[model samples]
Target chain A: EAGVTQFPSHSVIEKGQTVTLRCDPISGHDNLYWYRRVMGKEIKFLLHFVKESKQDESGMPNNRFLAERTGGTYSTLKVQPAELEDSGVYFCASSQVRIVSTEAFFGQGTRLTVV
Target chain B: TQLLEQSPQFLSIQEGENLTVYCNSSSVFSSLQWYRQEPGEGPVLLVTVVTGGEVKKLKRLTFQFGDARKDSSLHITAAQTGDTGLYLCAGALTGSARQLTFGSGTQLTVLP
Candidate 1:
C-alpha cells in the first residue's frame, strides 16, 4: 500500500499570506494526524481526525490555523494570515488502527517558508 | 510544557563505536516510541516500548523502558554510518484522547 502522501513538498510565501497544505493518508486508514516542527523544536502535534470527524484539536496553535478532513478521506491544514513563526515543516501521518500497536506512517512533509 | 526531554542534543562518533541516548519525563505514559528521521524525510518508527522495565533488542539496537514508565533509553552498539539520523522519543499518554508528546530529538552523526 502507498504511504501517506503530501503535496507541495516545499512552499514559500510572504508574511500575512494564506497557505494550505494537503495530505492524503493511506487507503482505509481511520486515523489521521498533523504535526509540525519549527527551528530546533520538537515535533509538536497539531490535530487529529478519526474519519471526517476531528478527534482532538487541543494542540492547535491559534485561530489563524485551521485543519479539516472532508468525506473521511484526505485532510487539509490552512494557515491564514500566516506569520513568520508559522514557517516550518508540516507533517501528516496516518495509522491503520487507533490502537498503540499500529505504526503511524508519515509523509515527506511540507516545508513552509514565510518570508 | 514539554512532557519529554532527551539528553545530549547532538552526538558525533566514529563508526564501530557505541552510544546511548536517553529520554526522560516526570509524567507517566501509557507507551513510548522511538523514531529515526533522515534529512528531507519524516520520522520512521524504530521501536515501541509499552511495559515498564521492558527491554527489546533489534539487532544491534537495544531499547529499554524505565520501571516507572517515565523514562526510556536507546543504545546503539557498533554504530554504523547508516545509523546517522535524528532520534526522537514520543510518549503516548493515558486516557481517551491519546496524543503523542515528542522530545526535542537527538541528532547523531556516525563518522566513517
Candidate 2:
C-alpha cells in the first residue's frame, strides 16, 4: 500500500558528471513514469514504462539521458556528463492503468543540482 | 508543442477567502487533472475531470472542466492555511494520452 518511492531525495554533482536516480513503484503497478521540472518551468514528462518495456520515451531530453526498467519492478534514470541545465527536480510516478485519467501515485522526487 | 497557461502565477490571501485558479490550453484533451505540490515533494492528485462540462467537488474544493475540453478551473472556498501549496494543472491530449502537458503552476499561500 505504499506510494511510489524515489531514492536520493537530493543530489549535488559537478557538471559533466554522471548521476543516477532510482524509482520503485507501488507493488503490482505496471506503469511507471519519469518527469522533470527545470527552474521556473512546469513539470515535464521524460518517459514511461510498462512492465519493463518502454512504452514511450519521446520526452527524453537527449541521448545523455538514459532510463531503464528491468524486470518491471523498478526504474533508473541516468544522466551522463550532465550539463548545468540538467539541474532540476526529477519525479517518478506509478499507476495500474495506462490511461492518463487513472490516478498516478507520485514520489517525493530527487532534486539534482549540477554545479 | 501543446502548452497550458495558468493565471495569477502567485497568490497570497488571508484565511477564509475564496480563490479560483484557471488552466487554459489551445489544444483539446481527453482529460484534465489538478494537483497540489508541497516543498520537497512531488505533485499529489487533487482531482480528475474526464468529460467536458463535468464538475466534481471534494470538501471545499470544486473542479470544473470546460465544455471544449481545453480548459479547467479549481475553486476553493473558505480556504485555510493548510490549503497553501503549488497548484498545477495537467492535460492529456486527445491523441497522446500517455503524456501530460502541464501548466507552470500557481503558488497559493493562505495566511491564517
RMSD of each: 1.2, 1.3
Tell me the lDDT of model 2 at B79. Answer: 97
lDDT of 1 by residue, A1-115 (tens): 7899998899999999999999999999888999999997899999989999999999899999999999999999999999999999999989866557336778999999999
Candidate 2 lDDT by residue in tens digits, B1-112? 5389998799999999999999998899899899999999999999989989999999999999999999999999999999999999988888784667789999999999
- Looking at model 2, give its docking quality level: medium
Off by over 4 Å in 2: A98-102
RMSD of 2: 1.3
Candidate 1 per-residue lDDT over residues B1-112, each given as its tens digit: 7779898799999999999999999988889999999999988889988899999999999999999999999999999999999999988876645568899999999999
Error of 2 at B61 (Å): 0.3
Candidate 2 lDDT tens digits, A16-97 = 9999999999999988999999998889999989899998999999999999999999999999989999999999998887
TM-score each candidate: 0.96, 0.97
